[model samples]
Target chain A: MSTSTTLEEPKTGTWDGGNEPLKASYGKLMMWFFLLSDAFTFAAFLIVYGLSRHSHLPYTGSPEEFQFSTEWWPIPEKVFNAFPGFHGVDLPLAFVALMTMILILSSVTMVLAVEAGHRMDKNDVQKWLLWTILFGGTFLGCQAWEWTHFIVGTEEGMLLADGTRIFGANMTMNQYGPPLFANLFFFITGFHGFHVTVGWILLVIAFISTVNGVYHKRGHYEMVEKIGLYWHFVDLVWVFVFTFFYLI
Target chain B: MAAHSDHSNEFQQTGEIPKAQTKVIWKTFFILVALTAVEFLFAFTMDAGTLRNAIFIILTVFKAFYIVAEFMHLKHETKALIWSIILPMALVMWLMVALISEGSYYFDSIRNYFN
Candidate 1:
C-alpha cells in the first residue's frame, strides 16, 4: 500500500496534466538558465578581445610618444591614478584595488545573508542584506570617481618629451596604446560596470523585502539565496576582468 | 532535505555556520593576488615576445579557472551542469585561437604586400 501511494504521488506530480514533465520552481530555475546565457555573452566579448590584441596595425606611435614607461598596453598604473588628496603621493591603480575589495567583501556579506535566510533569521537577514547593499553602492561610487579621473585626465597631464598629454580621455592610438585598445577597454569594462549597477539594484530590492518582513511572512529566505547567486556571479566576473584587463 | 531545512533554520536563529570543508574562496583570492604579482613582475622585467605573451595567457587561464570554479561555485555543482557551462566555453576558446591566428596572418600578409 505504501509503495502504491509513493508511486501515485510522483505520477500526479510528473505529467503537469500534459506531455511536458513538471520541474522545479519555474522562477528559480529560469534565473540559473538566464545567468548561464549571460556567461556566454561575456565569453564572446573576451574572445574578441584576444583576437584584436593579436592583430597588428601599422605601429604609428612609440611607447615614449604615449608617455608609457613600459612596452605593454600602457601599464594600468599609468592609466588609472587615484584622486589626489595627499600631494606628491603616487597612488597608481589604488582605486582599482579598492573596487576589487569592495566587490569581494560585498559577496561575502551576500553569502552570509543567504545563510541567514536558510535559517529564517529575519533580523540577521535584514542586517547582512543591508551591508551587502552598502558595499555594492560604495563600490559603484568608487568606480564613478575612477571614470571621472579617467575622463578629465590627471594632474596637469604629465607631459611627454614631444609635448603630448600623458593621461586623458582623448586616448587615440597616437596618444594612448592602440585606439582599439582604449575603445575595447571602455566598452568591456563599461558593460561590466553596468552589470554591477544592475546587481546593486537587485540587492536593494532584496534589502527592501527583508525590511518589509516579506520573507518572514513567506516562511523562507529563498529570494535572498537567489539574489546571492547573482551577486556572487558579478564578483566572479570581476576576477576575470582584473586578471585579463588590468593584470595581463 | 530535512537536514538542509534544519540547517537553514539554524542559520536564521544564529548568523553563522560551521565553515564549509572548502576554504575555496580565500584560496581563490590569494591565488589571484599571487598571479597578479607575477604578471606585474613579468611586465616590468620581460621584453615583448611570443614566449612572454604565452606565459601571460597561461597565467590568465589559471586565474580564470580558480575564479569560475571557486568564486562562481561551479565546482560544487552537478557534473552535468558543469559540463553544460564548460563545453560551450571550449567552443569560445577555439574561436578565439582561430580568429587571432587568422588576424595575425592577415596583418602579416598586408604588411608584406604593401612593403
Candidate 2:
C-alpha cells in the first residue's frame, strides 16, 4: 500500500521493493530496452558493411577516374549520384541529403507532438502528429525514388571483361563497384526504410487516437511520449546510417 | 495512470514541460541543421581520406547526441536510465571505432588483389 503513494521521488538505484530504479515506468523502461536491442541489430548490419568495405580495394582516383568495377569499391557519393529529373548531370549525394533533412524535420515535428501531449493539448498534439506523418511520408518517397534509380542503373551501364553488359545492380553483377555494394545498399536502406514505414503507421494510430480523444479521456498522453521515444530512435539510427553508409 | 500515482503500470503525463522547452527544441533543431551543413561542406570541399572520414564520424556523433539527448529527452532522465542505454551503446560505438581503425590495415592487404 505504501508503494501506491506517489509522493516520493524515486532515484537511481536497484528495485529493492517499492522504488523505480531508473525512475521510469515499467513500460518506458522496456521500450528503452527494445530500442537498445534494435540498436544492436543495426550495429551488426553496419559492422558487416565496415568489414566488407575495408576488405575491398577502394577507388582512390578522382571523379573522372571513377568507374564501376568489381576490383574496387566505389565512392558512395559517386554511386548514389542519380537525382530524379537531373539525369546525366552528376549531383552526388544531393537527393540523399534532402532525404536526411526530411527525416530530421519529421523528428522535429515528433518532439513537438510529444511536447504538445505534455501540455494535455489534444488539438496541438493532433496537429503536430499530422505534420510529423507528412514529413515521414516524404522521406519514404525519396527513398523509393533512390532505390529505383540505383536498380535501374545509368544510360551507358558497364562493360565487363567477359563481354557482359550489366545495366543495374543485382545479386549476380552490377554497374556499380561490386555486388556486395548493391547488396548492402538494399539491406541497410531497406531495413531503415522499414523502420520509417512502421514509425509512420504508429504515428497515424497515435493521430487517430488523439482525434478520438483517447489520451484526453484517459487523462494522460504518455502514449505520445513512448511513441516519441521510438520515433526519435529511428531518427537517431538515420544519423549513423548517413555517416556509415553514405559519407564513409 | 494519473501523475500522482507512482505504482501505476504505465507512465503518466506529468507537469508542464516548461514553455522554455520549445526554445530548447528549436535551438537543437538549428544546431542539428548547422552540423549537417558542415558535414555537406566537408563532403564536397575536403578530399577523401582518413581525416575527412574522421570528421564525418565525429559530426555524425554530434548530431546523434542532439537528437538523442534533446529530442528523446534522455538527458533529462535519471542517471540509471541514462547509463542503461548509453553504456551499451558506448560499447557498440567502441566496436565500430575498433573496426574502422583496423580498416586501413585491412585495406593494405586487400589492395594486393588488384596490384
lDDT of 2 by residue, A93-115 (tens): 89989999998999998998888
| Chain A TM-score (model 1) | 0.79
Model 2, residue A241: distance off in Å is 0.9
Candidate 1 has a TM-score of: 0.74
Q: How many angstroms is residue B14 displaced in model 1 relative to the true structure, after the best TM-score fit?
A: 13
Docking class of 2: acceptable
lDDT score for residue A200 of model 1 = 88
TM-score of each: 0.74, 0.88
Q: Model 1: clashing residue pairs?
A: A118-B8, A119-B8, A119-B9, A119-B12, A121-B12
Judging by DockQ against the true structure, name the best candidate. Answer: 2
Q: Native-contact fraction for each model? A: 0.31, 0.61
CAPRI accuracy category, model 1? acceptable
DockQ for every prediction shown: 0.25, 0.37
Question: TM-score of chain A for each candidate?
Answer: 0.79, 0.92
